[model samples]
Target: MNPFSYHKPTTINEAINLANLTSRFIAGGTNLVDLMKENVVRPKRLIDISGLPLQAIEATANGGLRIGALVSNSELAWHPLIEQGYPLLSQAILAGASAQLRNMATTGGNLLQRTRCQYFYDTGTPCNKREPGSGCPARTGLNRMHAILGASAACVATHPSDMCVALAALEAVIHVQGPRDERQIAFADFHRLPGDAPERDNHLSDDELVVAIELPPPDFAAHCSYLKVRDRASYAFALVSVAAGLKIKGGIIEDARLALGGVAHKPWREATAEQVLKGHAPSEALFTQAARVLLQGARPLSHNGFKVPLAQRAIVRALSEAAFGNTYAGATP
Candidate 1:
């Protein structure tokens, strides 16, 4: 790792003031530290924000939940409020990294985690995300874990956060503090699609820091599921995953929120599929149709084309389990 100066700031103002073009804020250092060790990200100054007052999980007046940026993944997953009110979020968190890593990964850090694209991690490879104007080797190389939706010619990387997938389904709001002022970014708009500039991951400015995340009122706690499929059962990145939450009334779907991970640069919210299942009865046929609608415009890469069908089946299985409030027979498969 490159030599760097470290600054531990106790206040948000101090953190923001210390941030510069060559500085990066470290909350849990689970992801940033790995990238730094890999030489993917080289920072001259490391601003440690763990000393700031951003570790609370409180209930909002509007029956929502406000989660501080420093809340650890393990804490958030097992918190009473989260487990009782937002089971999907809890499940999604538990579906991610190992227990040791989760204990050190923070909410804000997870949101800012980089993609797990092999080409991007290997500095010797030609990855546009790592070096702009360099060719994308994943475009024609071994790329089974690449994206199947919202990918561009420059990048085919997939976002690796399972928590963000559930957050996208819940429509959480991202609270950011920058040098200018504070602002709220809708979860849908927080992460950006890989357009021309694939190097930039999210919409956060260079100097901005994520303070907290505000979740909307809980509505699908009783009928929500997070299903992650991969090569092995435990501690593996998702090949295709689904975060499904549905509100069913008298055998008909009242409301639905669906999002897909491991498929794009950001969480792929299935708004079209949700619309199709809004007033329909929950059944295998209906769920299959909804999955079909979700994957309508998916443009898979050379080796990742199987993701189209795999993601569709995962969506169907997740919706089925959420609707019936029971695990499906082959949900994991």
Candidate 2:
């Protein structure tokens, strides 16, 4: 890692004051430290915000849950409230990285985790995300892990967060504090698509610090599933993943939530797809129709074209599992 000045702030205001365009905040250094070592990211200053009082997991007045930004993935996944109410989120968090890495990965840091690929990390190759205007080698190279939707010519890399996918389906709200004022951002508006600006990942400003993630309420606690498909069983980034939740009453779907990961620049969600399932009886054919609506307009890369169909089948499988409350996920050959 490059030489950088470090500052440990005990308060949130002090930590925000220490932040700037060239500075980066470090809580759980699981993702940031690796980027620094690979020379993919170099900050002039490192602001340590781990000591701040942002570690609480409390209940909101609206019967939802308020998860602190500094709460570790392991802690959040295993928390009684989370496991009992938002089991989809707990499953998604537990599906990421490893137990040791999850212990060091915070909720805020997970939201800000960068997209990864061979070209994005190797400084020797040209990657638009690493350096804007540079050509993206993944577009024509080994891109089995590249994006299939919301991908621009400038970048085909996909966000690698399993937690973010569940957050998208849960429709969580992110609260952030900036130099000027504090504001709340909807989960859908937080992560941005490539859209010629591959360098910018999220809507969070450089000086802003994410305070907490507010989940509205638990509705699909009994009917939810998190499915991750990867090269191996454990510690592997997803090739395609699905987070599905449904509220069924009297054999009819009342409400539905579906979000896809490892297939787009951000956690992919389409309201129309969810709408297709609502008010309909849960069935295999209905789930397949919903999957088709979700995967509409998906444009695949050179080597990752299989992701399109794989995501479709995975969506169908996830929705079926959610409706039936089963544990079976995607079946890969």
Candidate 3:
């Protein structure tokens, strides 16, 4: 890895100052360090914000949960309130990385983690995202893990954050400390699409530090779930994943949210699909229609044509199990 200065700030002010001067922020250092070693990202300095008081999970004034950015994946997955109230988030975290990785992956780091695109990782190849106007090798190269939604001609890289997928489904808000002051951005707007600049990943300013994530409390009695399908079970990124929350009463759907991961440049919010479930009874037909709506605009590449059907099935399976507990999840949970 390229040599770089390291600083551990004792206060938020010092942290912000260091962040302003540095190209990188190191929280858990799980993804950052790996990229640094591979020469994919080489920051002149690494500002360690892990020491700051950003590691707390407390109840919001309105009865929701506020999760500090430095909180580890494992801590979040096993937090008493989260496990009981937001099973979808907990389940998504547990399904990601591994037990050891979860212990090291922080909420802020996880959300800001870079994509797993092979061409982007290996800067030797042509990638407009890495080197603008250079050209995209993935367009004609091996790209089984490319994105299906919100992609542009410049790039088609998937956003790889399992927890963020669940957070999107729950309509969580991201809280960050910026140069001006603290700011709260809706989860949907936090992550950006490739558009014309795939290089810019999020709305985070150079001096901003992600503070915490605020999740509105879900009724513990209501059903919710996250389903991830991969080439292998553990320690593998999702080929297609679905996060869903549902409320059903009197044999009619009261509310629902569904977000797709590993298939979109940003968190794929299926608002159209979710609307189909509201005020409707849970049935195979309803689930099928909703799933179809979600995958309507999927544009697949040469090798990844299977992702569309697979993602659609994943959404149907996740919603069906979440809205109505299934034998599979029951046998496991």
**Taking the tens digit of each residue's C-alpha lDDT, what string does model 3 give over 1-333?**
888888888888788877754469898889998889889887988888889898999999999999999999999999999988898888889888989999999998999998889998896788777788887777678879888777788898998889989899989999999767999999999999988888888999999989999998675236787888888777888888888888888988988899999998878996888999999998878988999999888888888889998887777788788878861211111
Per residue, candidate 2 scores C-alpha lDDT tens digits across 1-333 of 789999999888899999999999999999899999999999999999999998999999999999999999999999999989999999998888999999999999999999888899999999889999989989989999999899998999999999999999999999999988889999999999999999999998888999999998899889999999988878889999999999999999999999999999999999999999999999989999998999897998779989888888888888888988775433342
Q: Candidate 1's C-alpha lDDT?
A: 0.91
Candidate 3 lDDT score relative to the true structure: 0.85
Of 1 and 3, the candidate ranking higher by lDDT = 1
lDDT of 1 by residue, 149-244 (tens): 999999999999999999999999999999989999999999999898999999998889999999999999989999998877678888888889
Q: Which structure among the candidates has the greatest lDDT?
A: 2
RMSD of 1: 1.4
- The global C-alpha lDDT for each of the candidates, from Candidate 1 onward, is 0.91, 0.92, 0.85
Task: Give the clash count for each candidate.
Answer: 0, 0, 0
Q: State how far residue 224 of model 1 sits from its true place (Å).
A: 0.7
Rank order by lDDT, top first? 2, 1, 3
Q: How close is candidate 1 to the true structure, as a TM-score?
A: 0.98
TM-score of each: 0.98, 0.98, 0.96
The C-alpha RMSD in Å for every predicted model, in order, reads 1.4, 1.1, 2.1
Which of the two candidates, 2 or 3, achieves a greater TM-score against the reference?
2
